[model samples]
Every structure is written in structure tokens, then in C-alpha cells.
Target chain A: MRKTQPYAFIMPSLLLTLALGVYPILWALRYMFYDYPGYGSATYVGLDNFARLMRDAEYWNSVKNTFIYAGGKLVLTLPLSLILAVILNKAFRGRQLLRAIYFLPTIISASVMSIVFFIIFNAYNGMANQFLMKYHLISSPINWLGADYAMLTTILIAVWGGVGNYMLLFLAGLQGIPNDLYEAASLDGANAAQKLFKITIPMLGPVLQMIVMYAITVALKGYESIMVFTGGGPYGKTDVMYLYVFKQFFPISADTASMQRFGYGSAVGFASAIIVGVVTALYFYFSRKMDKIY
Target chain B: MTSAKILTLVPRTILWLFLLLTAFLMLFPVALTVLGSFKTNLEVTVGATILPKVWQFGNYSTAWKAANFSRFTWNSTFVSAATTVGTLLVTTMAAYAVDRANFFGKRFYVVLQASMLFISIGAVVLRPQFDMMIGLGLQKSLWGVIIILISAHASIFFMLIGFFRGIPRDLDEAALIDGCNFYSVFWRIVLPLLRPALAVCGLFVFRGAWNEYILPLVFTMTRPELQTLTVGLAGLRYSIGSASETQLMLAGACLSILPMLVVYIFANKSFMQVSAGAVKG
Candidate 1:
């Protein structure tokens, strides 16, 4: 129980974070200012790489793509998860079993899920199209992986993979609400809808904020599924910022001449970090303000 | 009374239908994969059959050899197990210290935990961390990947520290009154009491490490011998080539998911409860 002994307890994790977390961030910052690649000596570029990113069309496309993906996911998935959570929160028979079934996808690897979705969303010979056609919903299969729907396809898969985790989160929040609040609202002649709006939504503000923050962050970090399904392909229609960064560093082709853009890629990476950081900070500011208001 | 009864039945029926539909949507992809795992490449692509014409259990064996899945699974198991143990030990000690031991930097530690709640740039950190790993001569090794998993998981442990802190200090004091030292108090009293939190944190770390793809993909490039299941599965995707639909690869993918599915089914309640509690906290 010595005063200093406890420091020994915390030192291992703190040191690990310093080595693996803090050090790499610093290294990335340093690398951004230098022209470094997987090979060759790094040269100090002094923001030239960043300056070049201002004019790079692909970087801008990726920025636009990242925002589109993040926005689409937030708009679609957040409301869906909230609705699902609200529905599942009601007392019903077999609810626990249903909860487990819904949560199964979130526990599995995204790579595995992506592959499964690839099959389901395949242009032909996939079950999804077969079902649609069988039901006479459409004459032909939807081109899910084509340029027009590729990004949408990615977003749908992301939403499907993600909704379960957030639903559980909202379920917890719903459970935390005291029953007396609902009783009071009922006594005031509030309908169920009115009670949900006045009592539940207001009380669940913090959890909702947390969900939005987590969802936005996840949307911004959408790489794994895109990597597996499209490889940002069918002519880069599915390309997002993270995929662009990956391709820059680890180009899949044999042409080393086109692959030596480490400085520019690092610049792009830094730009992405800045955008994500800004978005996260803005979310916090708004949430904190909302917290004060609520 | 009769009108009320009718109203209740309508809502209950609708709720049941909604829940059933949602559950079906969630479970359909997994069911398809499991069903497809039993079919041949020809049967998989040429037809739209819910049940395979002939169940080919041999696909499992084929995928096992094709992807060197045994070695990949071994590598994944070693990394995940080591990371889990490392995370538990480090997080437990840190949580114990942060929660029980009032120290000079308690406020700073609290801020550190809160900051961890926002640290979601693990993918961005991978490249630079790889550079640092290379500089430190730990690149292209399973140990390096394990270290990365442990570090990336520090936030979860930090959050667990907060959870542990919420537990009453009276328990620790009672243990001390019985002549238990700090270690004994932590080992016997606090750790046992924190099982719910521990299980939550442990499973979260395990699943994160197990399902991780990009980190291993980037870091373990030189050592193909050290690839994890995620990376191994990605490689398998290409090996099956244009000739194969998802059904051909479904068997391999299902095999990959079996370990997780088994773990999830047994521990589903604990997993859900703990994770839900953690998020709410």
C-alpha cells in the first residue's frame, strides 16, 4: 500500500500506450513533413506535400466520397438502429432470442460478413435478386455493384453490420429510464407517442449523443468492407479516403513508378485526420451544448 | 375493457411481426453462408437453390488446405489469446490502481480515460506504427502484431478502469481490514467482484483482435507465415478467383466464423449485458 507502488501498476499500460499509441501519432506527424516511403531515405518536404494535396483531384474525390459515405450511413443507419432498439425494448415473448439473432452479425468479422454480402448482392445468381424476381418485384436484378449502386451497396452492408451494436446501446438507454416517469406522463393524459417524445427522448439524450458520435466515427473509418467487396473498384466508384490511402502506400500493381507517392499519401492521411478530428470536435461541442440545454 | 383488450392485441401482434422481420433480416446473411458452405462451385453459381443439390462437406477440407487455414487459425489463436491475457492483466492492474489507489495524478488519469473514449484512429496509426515497429526491429512477426493489438485495445481497458472505479471502495477496505494486502485485495476481492466488467472487456478485446484485418494486412506483409484469419480469408477470396461465386468461398468463411459463433452462443447473454452496460456507462 505504499504511495509509489500504485504507480508501478499503471506504468505498464501507460508505457505501452506511449510506445504504440503516442509514438506512432508523432511519427505520422513527422512523416507528413518529410518525403518518406516504405523504402528510400526520407527527405524534409516542409508542407510541400500538403500543398500539393490542395490540387490533387483524387484527394478531393476521396474527401467527397468520405463525406458521402459518412453522411449516407449516419442518415440511414442511426434512425434505423434507433427504431429497431425502440421496438426490441418492448416486453415481448422470445425477445431475448430475437436480440441474439439481431446481434449475431456485429460479433462476426467484417471480412466474413462482407463476403457473405458479396454473394447476396451479386449481380446475378445471388439469393437477393432471386427472391426479388421470384416475388415478381422486378423483371431483372438490380445492379448492386455497378457504378450507380456500388457506394449504396457498401452503405447498406455497413448499416446491416453496424445496426445491432447501436441497437443494443439504445436498448440499454431505454432500460435505464425509470418507470415512474412513464407513469407520471400517463397520469398527465399523455398518449404513448407523446410519452415517448416528452419523457423517453429527453431522458435518453446522452445515449443518443454517444450513439451519434460513435456512428459518425465508424462511418468515417469505413474501410474494411470496402476493401473486401469492391477494392474501391468498378473504376474507383466505391473508393473512400482510407482506401485511397491504402492504395497509395501499398499499390497492388507492379508499376513502382506510379507507386512512389508516399509524401503525397502522408499528406492525404494528415488531411483525413484533420477532417475527422474536426468533425469529432464539432460533434462534441454540439452534444455538450445540447446536454446543457436538455 | 373489450376495446382495451383489442387495442393491446393489435400492438402486440404488430410488435411480434416487426421483431420477427428484423431478426430474419439480421440472420439471413449468416444462414445463407452456412447453407452455401455445403454446395460445390458448380452448384453454388449455376443455380438458385436454398438447399444444395448435394452437400459437399469436402469444401471445408479443401478450404483448409487451400488457405492453409490451420496455420492461420493457429496464428490467430496465439495472437488473440496473448492479447486477451495482456489486456486483462494490464487493464486490471491499471483499473485497480486508478480506482483503488488514490495517487498524485488521479485527475489526469480520469482525463486520460475520457480521451480514450474518442481514440478511433487505429487504422491511421497502423502505417506509422509499422514504421516504428520496423525501426525497433519487431516488424513482420506475430509478436509485433500481438503488441499492436494490445496497444490498440488500451482504450477498452481504460474504460474498464472507470467501471471498476464505480464499484464501492468499501469492499477493498473490508478486505484490507481482514489483513489482505493490496495484491490480495485486488486478486481475491476486487477482481472477482469485477467479473462482469472483466468478461465484457475481455470479450471486446478478443473480438477486436480476432476480427482485425487491416493492421495485420499492413504489418505482417513480409511474414506470410504469420497471417491471421482475416488476412487468410482475404487471400482465399482471390485464390478462388473469378470462377467462384460467394457460395464457393462460403464454406471457408463459415469455418472462420465457427469459433466466434461458438463463443458468442455460449456467452451471448453475458456478452450483451456487459457490453450494453459498458456503453451506457
Candidate 2:
């Protein structure tokens, strides 16, 4: 075979990738320097989009919200799923059935999860309010998707919708550990907690890195659920980075934002992508370093 | 029983109980949605009943027709099928070339695929891509959505790459020595060996494309006729304004979820094994 044969084989995907992924990224970078109200009406306004973003309170708030959501999901999901995986790892009746049930959420469409969450947390007679009020946990039904509670509600739903997928990953990690390690630990008189900390965690270093990276990236980029559930608001409290960019193009309502700033939104998107890229790269680099140390 | 045995037994039983409760909590929301589809929205929201008092079977039909789910499903099927075929062809050739073909820029393709997984921010690209799609005359068409869906799913490489690496390179050489061209070697020998991986990757691509929201939503915004199941269901949520029609929404959600759920159950073990392997890899 010719040396270029491989190139020929890969050209289709590479071209598609270029068109879909790389071209858009470049287009975004170019759009950053312009004032694009809509197509074919762009004006050369170099650095203006960047200047606006520097002072744009709403954009910065969305950045802050992205971090909060991402950080919360990372902190909440990793340990939660790890513990669940550990519990499910034990020899018990109905373990397979339970495992399947836990994984069920991962299979459901994001729209469905969003809808269910929206209804459950609906201010009036929603199941969440009913459940909480039933237990006297709160004085009254809280409008969970309302401005005051939107971020919290959004984060919880993200966790609920996401945990099952990560739990299964953790479960796979647990199953990968050699039985002999646990046996040796048992011989050393290690308790369950000790075994978890010493054997399971140390063994799961790579998986932990993978999961953390996934959780952070997912949390940062997640918008569909929030869009469906809250529409990024009661105000703009629940707006994350991606949702902010998305709403820039497709505003919450037509009359409210008649002038869509396509150029500005693209600049924000480009900048956020850079931030995410750097953070993700930092995570990968440090995790690889951790691998070396271990 | 001895106190030692009883102590272990007691804790084991406690653990079992705790796990049982956690599992129930996990399943409760989804179960409620499925069950709620059978009842009026008032019963679902106003009361927390495990089962409907009188099962409302008409909700599914009402949702099915009202949401124009038949159109949605047809579009979804077209997009998903096209995506699956395109992805399989692209991934298989790409994987083969990367694994076997000792060509220039081999390293570049590998790195490119990896970066595709890492640096993904198509959110910003929405405008340009939309414009480009229009330029290409694919805007607001299933083909536009299908093309974009195929591009977005680089993760299908996860299973395929791993599987390709596992196959022996000697087979490729043997076919080459048999006077076979690269395509024949790939098609006749390497591709046959990839049957299992193909099955796993195909299902994943199909399912991902089926569930995809944003791409379809944007591409089909002007043409609701081209909207996928997810886009339709999302629209259905707002259209069912009053709580009286909430069951219709739930039933619609059920309809959207049913195909994937049924497929997952049937392909349960294969799916689990493939994901487990993919994650570990």
C-alpha cells in the first residue's frame, strides 16, 4: 500500500472534523473582532467584543455560575458515586437488578430528566415541595426553579441525572481490582473503611482522574437540562457558560432581546472554550504527574 | 448462631437494607414518571400515589398524535440511521488506517482524534455552522443534522480504537502478501475481525444520535417537520401548559424514552461489557 493510503482513508473524517469543529472555532475567533448583528452584515470592530465581555456583568456571572455548577458536581458526584459503587460491589442478593436500576438514569433522555425534574420541583403541588413539606422540612412550598433556588435546583438535577453514569464507571473500576489485594488487606486486619481508603482508592487513581475530568467538563458545558428546566432563569441565575452562549443566539424570548449579538456571543464562546481547554489540560497534566508519583 | 457469626450477619443485613433503600431512591423519580403517565396530572402533582387510581391509557395515544411523534420518530430514525452508517464507515476506515496503515500524518490523526474528545466547544460555533449549512444547502434538513451529528460523535473511536489495537497486525500482512490491495485487505480481513466492535460502536452511535438535542434543534428550528424526538418532546412540555395535560407530557417522555430503554434491556450484557471495557481502556 502507498504511504498516503492511510491519509486517503482518514480524509473523510478529518475534513468533516475540520468543517464542523475547527472551522467553527476559527469562525468564532474571527467573529470576535467584528460586530455581527447577523450574517453578511458584519463590521470590523477589533477587540470590541473582548472589551464588552470585560465589563459585561451578566457574562462574568455566567462564568461564575459555570464554575459553581462544575465544582459542585465534581465535589458531590465523585464521592457519592464512589460510595455507591462500593456498596454495590459487595456480595448481595438482587445486586444485578440493583445495578441495572442504578444505571437506568444514564439511559433516559436528557429532555425527559429535565421535564421530570421541572415537574417534581414545580412551585405548586410539585412532588419535591410536597415531599419536603410533608416531612416539615420547610415552612412552605418553595419555587425550586424560581430565581432564588434555581441554581441549587439545577445543580441537584445535574447530579441526579449524572450520578448513575459515573457510578457505573466507579463500579467498573472496583471490579477491576484484584481479589488478592482485598484478601491481603483483610489478612492485615483492615476494616471496611480502611480497605476503601487504602486499597480501593489507591487502585482507582486513574479512574478517579477520568471521572473528575468528565464531571468538571460536563458540569461546565451542560446547558440542555438547565435550558429545559429553568430556561436559564427566573432571572439569569442558573445561566452557565454554554447556556449563556446558547441564549445569546436563541434568546429566552423574542421581544426581550431584539438585537442578538452574534459576534459577542461567539467571542464569549471562544473565550470560554479557552478557559475550559486550559483547565482540562491542567487537570490532565497534574493527573499524569500523580500517576508518575504513584 | 455464635455471636461472631451473628455480628457479621447483622451488619451484612444492615448493609443490604441500606443498599435497597438507595436503589429505591434512585429508581423512584423514573418510576413515578412512568406510573404518572397512567394518571391525571392532578393525581400526579397534588398527590404522591405509587399507582394511579384509575389507569388512563389514552394519555399515550393523545401524546403520540398531539406531539406529532410519528414525524419526530421518522426524522429521528433517518438521522440516527444515517449517522450510524456514516460513523461506522468513517470510524472503521479511520481506525484501520491508524492501526495498520503506516502512512504519513498517522500520528497527526491520532492526536487529532484525542483533541476532538478534549477541546469541544461547539456552542460558540452555532452561528457559523448554521450559516455554512445554509451555504451548503443543508440547513433545516435532516441531512444537515445528520452530517453534524456524525461529526460530533468522535467518542465512538473509544471502543473502535481499542478493538483495532487488539487485533493481530499479522493478518493484515498475510492479506497484503496474498496480492490483495489495501481496501480488500481491510474489507476482507480486518473488517471481518471487527464485527463485535462494529456492533458495539454502531449501537452507541445510533443511540447518541437518537438522543442528540442541540444539533437537531438548531438545524431544524425553521422546519419543525425535520425536528427529532427530543426537540418534539421539549416543545410538548411547554404546549401542555395546564397541569391537566401533564400526563400527556409524561406519556410523551415515555414514548421518547421507550425505544432506547427497550433496546438497552435487550442489549444489556453486550452494552455493559463494551462500556466497561471502553472505560477501562
Candidate 3:
């Protein structure tokens, strides 16, 4: 009874993980080599999918755009969140309220928030343009969602939505740093910048590494807001890897002529996963090497 | 002394000013959405004002009807509640067994879950996942989504295991010595002690299920009636024809945010602590 009891308890979750989590991945791997449209039997066209993937311009374009989007978001978000964390970590009035307010965006649905941003950044009369024109910040409203600025606009929204969560993480990292280090630095006549650069950031190394790793994976994976905002439009300027994978699987609009190419999509999906994996592995490798230097 | 005073005060004042400016930026969009929800569609489109000329509380009702929000709300609540309950049940049971008994393949199971947590396949496998649901004859039901959400419980399992280890085995042993079976020991004894851990995990699971977009979006594509609030709200983007229905969309956005806001208000402390705990784990 005791021996069988353990299996009884663990079986439900294990089986669930296997069926939903593991099975789909294996299914995708198998489908990668086939040429199955959703309705037909999959035909094994060995190495054809890989060869097509190599020649696919759109897939590689999305890969380039993914790096740009992720890179732009991280560049802006990390420093902004760090600064906010340092400020909020101080002893001040309404500190908790401030932290909560910043963290508020993180809780809201990304799609819903992006819709609101869509309104705010509307080309004609969006509050962003209105306010800017009202203040004479610009003579005319710029088309924020145009091809010239769509990626930039998306990055700004991403930063706005993401900064708070990372700030909270940074705040947690800040809290772990002992105060005596700052006090000792003060005894040596260290100024605010010196103390921050020399002591606080060094102490935050481990937490920072973890948060960066987390942020990288999330930024790469995130396409919810973009999907709602642009539908990978304006000549597919803002198309990321996952969004492209999604479009391949399910056409957003009825007019899509070449939708539901399951076999090729599975191949694309596999390639996307490998790219993400390789990037993650490279991050781990580089971060480890930096650890040795430090 | 006067020059020194000016130097110290200057930076401090600038710092406070900058912080307040950031706070304003953070609150602006949400404030605009809420206020816009009450304005007329023409007023919203004009962007000529900050406040509504006359508060149109009727927009909420209009939005509700137009978006089929009542059904979506129910669907969201049902899925989130069921996912949380199911996840808590299976994860807790698994955590207990793994923490207590030395079962065969136990190490392998733990390692598998850990690797699953690290190796995310993202949206790549959505096709196969949908196909698997069709295979199970559950492609038309919300149960497919609930099951998938519950299965992605690697983090929750690890969290519960950590919580489980902190709980002394002496209590379980005492219950067992009292002629209680393993199930009873779990049900009557340890389950009661796991309330704190359960609450945190429950909140997280509920929030994830509630705010989830992609899975529900894909699964409910064929059955529009099964769409959760997030999916339904996103569908409202252009569904009301060429006019865009900005006011209605704002009203719906506000409505979708309410349940999550209520949860956040009630458990504000736990929410902050969870973010902090994430890094440590």
C-alpha cells in the first residue's frame, strides 16, 4: 500500500506534464519533417523543411526584428528599472504606494493595455499627439504607428509595461545588499554615485544575472501586445519570431491565402525554439565567463 | 553655509521632481482609460478634453452587451478558478509524495520538472497542443485550456515542495500511528498546515489563468462563446465595425481590469512578496 501510494499521488501531475507539456514538443519534432496541411496526412519529405527554412527570407527577417525589439526594450528597461528601484528603496513618503503604482501595469493584461496604448498613440487624435501639439512640443502629429516608427513605438510600450516588474526585482536585489557597505563607503568619503557604482551594483551581481536571464527569455517569448497592437503589419516591420509562428498556425484574418501550413510551421517553430535555446546558452556561457573574471 | 544649503537642496528637489514625473507617466494611461470610458465616442475620438462632458455610465452597460462581457466574465472566472483548484490539488499531492516517500523514478521526475521550467518551448508547440486536445475529444470545451494550464505547473510544484519540506514529518507520523491511512494523513493533517503556501500559489495560478491570452485565443477560435475575458476583450478591437467604438473598448478594458484589481487590493502584500521570493528561488 505504501509503495503504490506514492505512485498514486504523483501520477496525476506527472501524467499531465507528460501529456500536455512533453507530448506537444515531441509531436512538433515529428511533424517538422512532414508536409502536412491541417487536413491531410503528413508526408515525410526529409530535409526539405530545413532547406526551405534556410531560404526563407521572412523567417530570417523576423529573427532580425526579434533581436532589435528585444535589444531596444532591454536597453531602455534595465537602466530605467534600476533607477526606479534605487529611488523607491529609499526611506520616503508614500514609498509603498509608489511601488504599487509602478507594479500596477505588470498585473494588467498585456493585450488590454496595448489596446489602451493604441488609443493613446493613435495617429490622428491620440492623447500622446494631442498633448504634444498642445504643448507645442511638435508642430504636427507624427504617425506613431508608421513603418518608420512602429518598432520604436512598440519598444516604448514594452518598456512602460515591463519596467515595474523588473524594478520590483531590482528592489528585492537592493534590499539584499547590507547597509554597512554603504556606511563604510561613506567613512571613506564616497559620494552617491561612487557608492552606487562600487558597492551597491557589485552586491547585486547574482540577482542581476538571474533577472537579466529571465528578462531575456521573456522579452524573446513575448508577442502578446505586439499581436494585438499591429498584427505584424506595416509591411511586417514589427514581426517577431513567435508572432510569425502564430500567423503560420492560425490566420488572424480570413483573407490569408496560405494559412495553416502545419508541417512548415512545425519546422519554423523548431527553428525558433533552437534560436532561443542557442541565445540562452550563449548568455549562460558569457555570464559564466564574466563570473570568472569578477 | 548658504551655498552649501543650495547645493544639497538642489539635487534633493530634482530627485523628488523626477520621481513624481515618473509616477504621473505610470498613472496617465490608466487614468485616461477610466475617464475615457465615461465619455461619448465622439468626445473620445476628438481628444479635445481630459474629463467627460457628462458621465455616461450607460457605456458600461452598452460595452457589456456589445462585447458579451457577461459570458466572457463567467468563462474567465470558471477557467481561473478551476485551474487554480486543479493545480493546487495535483501539485500539493505530488509535492507531498516527493517530499515524503522515496518512490522509484522520483529523482528523474524532479529533474524532468526542473528542466521543463528552464526549457520553455514558447508558442512553437501550440499546433501540436491543439491537435492533442482534438485527439482527446475536448477540442470544443474550456476543459482543454484548464488542463493545459494545470499541466504547466513546474514552478508551482517546486514551490510546494519547498513549502512541504519546511513542514515537519512528525505530524504525518503521528497521524499515521493513529491508524490513519496515507490519504487521511494528507487530507486531515498536512493539508491544513499548507494554507499559506496554497494561498500564494492559488493567487499566482489564478492571475496567470486570468491574464492568459494565447492559449484561450487559439482554443476558443472555433467556439466564440468559450472565449475568456482577455480574449473577448481583444476581440472587441475591431468587431464593432469601422467606427472603432473607442469608448466601448475603453469601458470593456476597465471592466476586464476590475477583478484583477480586487484581487491585488486584497492581497497587496503577498503580491510584492511573491516577486521578491521569485529571485531567491
What lDDT tens digits, residue by residue, belong to model 1 across residues B1-281?
69999988998788678877878888888887898889877666656677888888887887777558788889889888999988888878987888778899867765765665565433446767776777888885777888877875546765686678678988888879999988888889888888877777788888888888887887766678898888877776666673563554787688779898999999998678765875655
* Ranking 2 against 3 by TM-score, winner: 3
Q: Tell me the lDDT of model 2 at A108.
A: 76
Clashing pairs in 3: none
- Candidate 1: docking tier: medium
The runs of at least 3 residues in candidate 3 whose Cα sits more than 4 Å from the true structure, single-residue gaps closed, are A254-257, A289-294, B174-181, B242-244
TM-score of chain B of each: 0.89, 0.94, 0.93
lDDT of 2 by residue, B1-281 (tens): 89999989998888778777867777888887889889987787887667899999988877777768888888888988999999899888888887776776778777877888877554677777887888999884788878877786568765788899889988878888989888899889988888988888888788788888887877777788888889988877666574667787788778878888898888865666666675777
**Model 2 segments beyond 4 Å from truth?**
A90-92, A131-139, A253-256, A282-289
* Candidate ordering by TM-score (highest first): 3, 2, 1
Q: Name the candidate that leads on TM-score.
A: 3
C-alpha lDDT of all candidate models, in order: 0.78, 0.80, 0.86
* lDDT score at residue A113, model 3, on the 0-100 scale: 91
Every candidate's fraction of true contacts kept comes to 0.58, 0.60, 0.68
Top-down DockQ ranking: 3, 2, 1
Show the lowest summed lDDT stretch of 10 residues, model 1 chain A. Answer: A252-261
Candidate 2's residue-wise lDDT over A1-294, tens digit each? Answer: 477787888888889888987798888878889898875688989998999999988888889988888888777878878888898888877878877777777777786678877778889878888778777899888988877888888887777777777888888888878899989989989999999998888888787777778877877888888778887677678778788888777664432375677888888887888888888889898788546535
